[model samples]
Target chain A: MKNSFVELHARERALSLLDAKTAREIVGPLDNMISPHLEPQNIVPESDDGIVLMRGMINGNNVLVVSIEGKFQGGGIGEVSGAKIVAALEKVLEENKQGNTIYPIIVLDTGGVRLQEANYGLLSISEIQNVVIALKKYVPVIGLVPGRVGSFGGMSITASILSYLIATNKARIALNGPEVIEQEAGVREFDSSDKDLIWDTLGTKQRSKTGLVDEVVDDTVDSIKDAIVNEIKTKKDAHRTENVDFYLSLLNKLDLSKKLDIDSYNKLYQSVVATKHEVPAATAGNKEGTKSRGRLWFEKLTGIENATSSISTVLHAQKDGKEYIAIVPDSDNKFPRVREGEVGLQEGFAVASIVNKIVADDKDKTVKRPIVLVVDVPSQAYGYQEELIGIHVALGSSAAAYAKARQAGHPVIDFIPGDAVSGGFLAHGLQSNRMIALDDDSITIQAMSKASAARITQRTIAELEEATKHVPAMAYDVDNYEKLGALYKLVKGIGSWEATDENVVKIKQLINEAITSLDGDTTLHFRYQTPIAKASGRKATLAVRKLVDEEWSK
Target chain B: MEKLHFNFDTKDAISKPVHVGVVASGDLEVIFRPTDKETEVNIVTGSDGFKEVWGNVLQRFFDRYPIQADIEINDFGSTPGVVNLRLTQALEELKDEK
Candidate 1:
């Protein structure tokens, strides 16, 4: 039998099972709401519309359901379809205002924008993301992935961007599908064949184990329904302490990737698989150590087109008698060599000192400047010698610097003038309160190529490409990284160094406006979209806010 | 391909499907009911020469849990611990009247 929510509308909306008639209401074209993409593709349009918008009562509470069918033009979304989803989300938010919180359940199944429709689908996707983000404010977005057409493309990325994701053992999530990797990186990288291996790589189990997916269940309606009901019942319960420590402990263990090999990866997998660690509980109310007292303001200054050829530069303070400084701390594990005689200190000490300087410089000033995190590291230093020297601490020190800047009423605004990859990117680029990439010129997150991932997965690139035709995440590029919410913006350019007198003037104006709305003490506003505090802390109230909002509005 | 029809009426066999308690490691469970209609049995496995071995095992278990039902089994190297538990649990769940 088809699952209640995933199957066709007629089956899902049947009034027989539900207590109220809301569940079975006809939507879409059945209600005359067909997508514009279907007409062009010459596909027989689904009567209820491509976007399944089901409104009904589930277990005594009102709920909203939004789903996309992969079979229909690969479920590529267009304006009308996107608008319907946003409308449903907006309605949920309105309901929250009225005290009848709605839940938003997105049964994701798509390959992304309808390539045939071109930019229409792409623009629609942006709007959809905005809607989802807004809906996240009032209610939680429960991402559900199932069926033969695993979530990928924009839909999959959206799922990843959501606060809580529920995936079946059958589901898979990724940005670039496998075929794109094969095309760009060549066949040596990813072999899409060997179904078992591919499934293992992108399966829900792998994602859940990695903490990307919140839950994994059997492919059945009852299993899913039961889980949802469980959340609803305990939505007001306190959070567990274990979740808080999990992130810190996981960060401590992140080195598994630094010395990555098949053997080491397998060992890590075995350790996780062999034991189910009891996640610690979080304290009720705002815990002392976790609260932030001030807001961090960030802005951008576009660099020159070709003359300076830099997006944003991290300038060093003066050294000796000169106003210019050089040689910070040794960062590279192997070549702990600082840029000798250079105006800036060594990379290691520079990151630490920059935080100190930025915070101190802005302390007495009425309006604080966003710490400009000048990033331009090609790759993390790699060598056997470096491994023994504890690179994690070096990276941690850099993280500490960003954390300090964030706590001191300063936002870490990272400008990627060049390449950012792996741990290097996480240490600098990702640490920013918000990261904005330079339009198409910057190479953001997603290091190596499909070939690299394929090599790691042990599949021939051609085979992987062929397989990716069905598996969507492998078909990706730098542009696809934007869909993952990693790159907050693709700006034209932040302004030039020569125009700095004017640039600083404009930058200060923008900074002043941002700071005006902030509470002087709070360093940051936990992006409300995050359910980590609720899930790990097991804070029932926090959990309810998301649950109620999702049910009523989304 | 061979065709086989199966129907067993065991004294203690249950007639409904109900709660789900275990789907974790080392255990599998489901329920079955004799809808008193057309039902069939088919078992194919990669493990060599286990047809009669499986048939006899199913026949004995069906008698013990005698409930009329159609049974289908797909094996992926399951252990003996799993086989008995799955059969019993499935029977109990089928007996549960939702």
Candidate 2:
């Protein structure tokens, strides 16, 4: 018999997946409540705002299934729909805390944030991320990424951090949508019409190969049900420690210089795994006594002997007669996953604590010392333990602390000498008032790695390179990043990766210039005012903001 | 967006409140609450040009049921078929509840 569940809508999918006659929807359509914002935009709002929240039984176990209706606004999340999802998750968290084992199953068909609502969507996603991390402590949050409108944007980050992700063969999951990437990076980087490329990059099978997806099943409801059942029964609570060494070694072995297909990526993964078994155990702990480029720069910039403290990855220093905090990778870190400069739980908390402490110390003072971030992070450490310990909050806390520090009249500047990628960049440098980077080929900045991006967009490195020439957002080099108007200044004439005396002089001069230029200005509104941001099609964003403001005023 | 309200004379009174359908795209929901007097209907729809069609469909629904109740509908471009189906389902559910 042909299965009818494959063609079901999102609400139907939720009801079908639950135990027969057990699903009771809360805040459902009959409530006659709809989005207030949609009416202003001349859009008819759905009563439930495109989300179905049902308290039901799945395989006789109490569960909450939150399904997004992709047909409505491409399953974009606005205030009401976002609130429903958050409230449902919050309810689950509350029940779980009361010792009631309420499992959460999020059926993600969203295209991420709703651009019409803009800031509200952004805020809601952030709140959702915070709650998702909190919920994981009680039960494994299962994510079902079926096709139609596969999860993108902030939802992709949320999906990646889930305890167990089950995706259909047709499902596409990625941090950046192909169309957005194409718009930002150019057609050569990501052709929106290239179905094969999009699928190969973000399809369930590809994500499975990359270890981002836990299980890939057929599109049928039975298959999905069985996968979720199996996960609930057999999956262990996710912890980063389990996969730290593996990821660290795998990331170490990855050759980003070459165009990597799934086959090549898997080969590299296997080689790393094989070599891991052959390597001496002693070398794993030998990260001590070895100074990273960040540490070397910290020492040179500070010009103080033995100035570095014994903190995990956070380096405290005095530069140009001013105290600054620098978070760098501790290659010999006890947390193996973050040892290679990826921000993990410890690094996140450390950065937050150091910054928070600095803010607290200078609370009464009018002139807060400048905080310099020596950034070279590849990405947030991706593993089970990181998620288990709530890496989102850890990274979020650090970001919040920097924002706090900047608001408190401190000049926060980011000096990038290495890879500044993904959430690591967001947590460390993106919040700074002014950012300076060495104009070196070695310095790269973008969201996530190229291999992952190439997979998500189904393009080769050559295509990405070609697109980078036209689309500054697609480019990882500092020169292109400078074109985005995100960076305050880019210093040239740095001879090597190491901080030489002359290089330090140039950097310090630029740092002072950056600080002076800030003139106690803390808001990041300056980014929109940049000529590059205005010229490079940020007009749409500005226009939307203006429209939203106009609507709000009335 | 449009809002319409109508009150029609009916013979029977609904005993309790009942709800049906979903407010997905091209769909709607109806909630019926017990009323001792005239049957009242309230509609809020996304479609701007469908006031006359909505009136006709709702009038037909009240004609078929003839029940005294307060009816509320929140629609998102739902068609005549869906509107009738939801009204029928809501009335049927109300009868079952009684």
Candidate 3:
């Protein structure tokens, strides 16, 4: 018989890894509890909600294993399953606080967030992330991503944040699923039928080279067991204690534009490792006075000749003649990974701080100053250190801050002059009451890179391109995104990437129009009212949400 | 989804509660808890169309082993053979518990 652990079911995998005789399942099928949400959607509720939680012994140490059943609903997490996992982790944390030792091992095989119960799934994931960060302080939260479904969406971020991650060659990890990316970004960017491309982009081998995955093991029970034992035995908390400046200097030495293959990634890795011993030098004589693309846009929009740059990446400007903050990447930024305007740990916290401050300042004021976000973030910075420090919390905090600001009556407007990709866009722009993007090729917005999209969707770039022609969501161009009703306006005739005085004036007029259109209505529900959203399968989500609300009220 | 309840008259009772099988696709779980009243079996299945087949299977198993216990089964489209196997396994565990 083949010794591949990948072929084993979720229960079998968990049982095989732990001491077989001592393993006992918590909230096992016998509990008779299933998801209440799935039934209304005519979806079958598995006895355990497709998540197997067990208390067991691994190499004589007490451990808790949370395994996802990929065969069940693509191992998508719903309320019950999410709660079960969270409860188990919380219990472990509580036990540890009382001087009991119990390690957490998560076997991830999820596509992330059960779309059937979207809002609940989102809330559950946030809770899961909070507990994961809290639990990491005591024990190393080990993540094992074996193949079949692999891990994507919110779970991908969850796995990335683990203290130790082990994956087999068959495993793939990504922020967004291939089909979802294809559905949103178009076939031209990510063909959903190309298998080789998907593996090439998100496969364990490539991810391991990037240093995101701590260990790559063979697809055998013994190999996985050994790796887990070794990690629990020897691995200390590898949290980076050096300031953001240390990472910035290290990032500055290497190139970030290389294709994400093993060889190219390894070269960059070697370069970063090679410079670790060198003393951190001051960031000087490297175009210190020059403003980034984001700051330039901020200057143009606010008419502030020299807007005071605060928190390095975050720039403070005047909007509607009031204090407005614009977060941009510093080209000479100390945090190298987030230099090109990617919202890293520092940027996320900075954005949150600014928004929270604005909210505090405008607490008693009848009229709130509009917070204009000059959106040019490419993506969240992808690095081991960033994950170790819980970038999700930082990113989630920024999103929450924007939501809070809007609820506080601040007309949050997102001006997309450049790319707003993935979690970066989610943190900065998605929470805005009204969003305006430059109708230019440079203004691309999507969950991830086109190459990653193509790989996940198993489609050739050509197929993805062809699909984009028919599907507006698939196209990354701001024009295509505008059709989705997420954007209130798209400014045309921008002659250059650098906004001219005329272009700036036009954009400012549009922002005023957007703010006026809001008419003190600060909710983000207006996005769903767009023709595209109403037509493109959002009706089901709306209906389900309505049902959920009606039920909740009862 | 189908919900069915069955009762089998018996004198003997299960010594302890026992759980067997996983709720994976095409699989089912049988959880047996000791009850003083009667041997009651409650079943909830993924497929609503298999009500008669489930009744027949449970009837046969209860007839074969007249153990007085409250049995609850959550099935995810399991075949008759799989259901029979899980019930037998749970019964065997119950027997071993004595």
Candidate 4:
């Protein structure tokens, strides 16, 4: 803790000290396994300390550990670090293809690639991505995000590319940090000083809520180990395909009415709006808090009255044991202790259900099943108990279900009622075949205001405004993401609840059109254009052709 | 020095060059050669430093590749992506089929 790499080194040393077998078994970087890029920078790098690629036994099964040392430049990746990672990834991939029993685990706590060695570092990051794809072909690439520095930028994408992700409450993951946001957009869009805002925007809870993170856990070595063990135990078959029809169908179901526009999309998708009470829209327990800006937007778009507005409302709905959608009021609610021996249908289940429907429907046209994704997740349930139970496993189970749905060929769609930001959106919203958000008026990206963006970027509110005009990346609007090719479509103007049935029908229609467009080839194009739901049928075909040519020759 | 100019007709336009990846510290680059070689590749780098090495590398590479291609690879330094691209061009150039 005193030093960043101090704990990392100690962990490595512990491995060495565990037994002579440990030392012999652990292939420390001291064995000249350094990256080639380091020498050009003239930095004397430690071999064993940089990236520890250990091939060892975990309960009589072989596993590969790719641990980055936080002490080494905040555990930021560089050429050597990247090469080691890629090499390990390549080796593991090759081994997996050969039917070798090796589980690949990455200990992530990085600030992306080190600027000091930019080019090589960046390339390595890309290679790491390729390796992740390759490795995922045969085994899970478990990313461990705990402790300081966390994961950001290229590292965040790396996490995104992985088969599974595990995070602690202390862990934070974002494409760009708060300070960067502030610097780029100015403090008006985000304020770093607000602790709650910071956590809600980029923290594990926020990410879990948005569907970016697979699970959340407590900060401890043992907790992390348990999560991984659970993931391996419940691992499913991989689904690597290039089919646009399934994803297109899912996107069709994401009912962004013709009225909704980009601004509304950004507001509902990125921002969080608490109901009348000052309680956060997300977070379990209170259930009687204020509605999220997303929910309000949904209500506005749909012209539907909030029939249930209190925890008592949820209680009543549950009491009836009827499958009716109740607008979940957000407040601190940890009351619904995950019952022992019971895995209830949470938001993740909803997302996976949608995906499964699409996959299943792809094979059979007669199957017209409606896949419903309940939009009441206040982010994936966080805290000590969730960690103890291994939230990542639960979350991954949901993600795997979605993957299966894609394989089965059904169109899965989603609509964000409230608070569709970070991990929650990623898990429940993103993985779906298509995602649509309510045209919420009060929806904003930062939980509070621009004040949160200022903390991380060290810029005043005025500065972000000035910068945003030029730097599209700095713009806090959700519409920018769509422009940047992150989101597929943004509905112009419509309340959330009013268009529920219409949205469902429209989505199904769109999906049907998409399925008709796809040919029989499952190539790279399908992977790129089909999965995201935004790319059109033509684009998907182009992507498939491009990737096929590129990958086939390679 | 005999400049053996090899050319092929391409079915599609080679758009413009949008290069990615690296050859080596001083080597590879992915070059977009707009050619008529339906899909053929011709590789010619300054073999001054690595003539035999380059030939060995390309020879082994071409063996796995389907022939009936025309590709001209003028190498300053390129990466694997570029190499693959040049070969692809050769294949396209040599192609008379749809």
**iRMSD value for model 1:** 15.8
Span of 10 residues, lowest total lDDT, candidate 4 chain A: A315-324
Writing each residue's lDDT as its tens digit, candidate 3 over A8-119 gives 8888889998985878777767555577655544445667778888788998999999999887777877666776776677778777777798999999999776644443
Off by over 4 Å in 2: A20-22, A30-33, A237-262, A269-554, B4-7, B15-19, B35-38, B95-98
Alpha-carbon RMSD, each predicted model: 17.4, 12.6, 11.0, 17.3
Which of 2 and 3 is the better model by lDDT? 3
The TM-score measured for candidate 1 stands at: 0.45
> How high is the CA lDDT of each candidate model?
0.44, 0.67, 0.70, 0.45
Report the lDDT tens digits of candidate 4 across residue range B1-98. 01123333335554433222222223332234444446554443433345445555555555565343333344434455555565555445444232
Candidate 2, fnat value? 0.47
- lDDT score for residue A61 of model 4: 52
Please state the error at residue B82 of candidate 2 in Å.
Answer: 3.8
Report the C-alpha lDDT of model 1 over A34-129, residue by residue, as the tens digit: 443333322233333356667776688667777675554456655455545655666666777677777767777776554433223433454455
Query: How far does residue A450 in candidate 2 sit from its true spot (Å)?
Result: 25
The global Cα lDDT (0 to 1) of model 2 is 0.67
Q: Show where candidate 4 strays beyond 4 Å.
A: A1-105, A111-137, A140-327, A330-397, A407-410, A416-419, A437-453, A457-474, A495-508, A511-554, B1-98
- Residues A251-288, candidate 4, lDDT per residue (tens digit)? 22333333333234334434443222111122234322
Ranking by DockQ: 2, 3, 4, 1
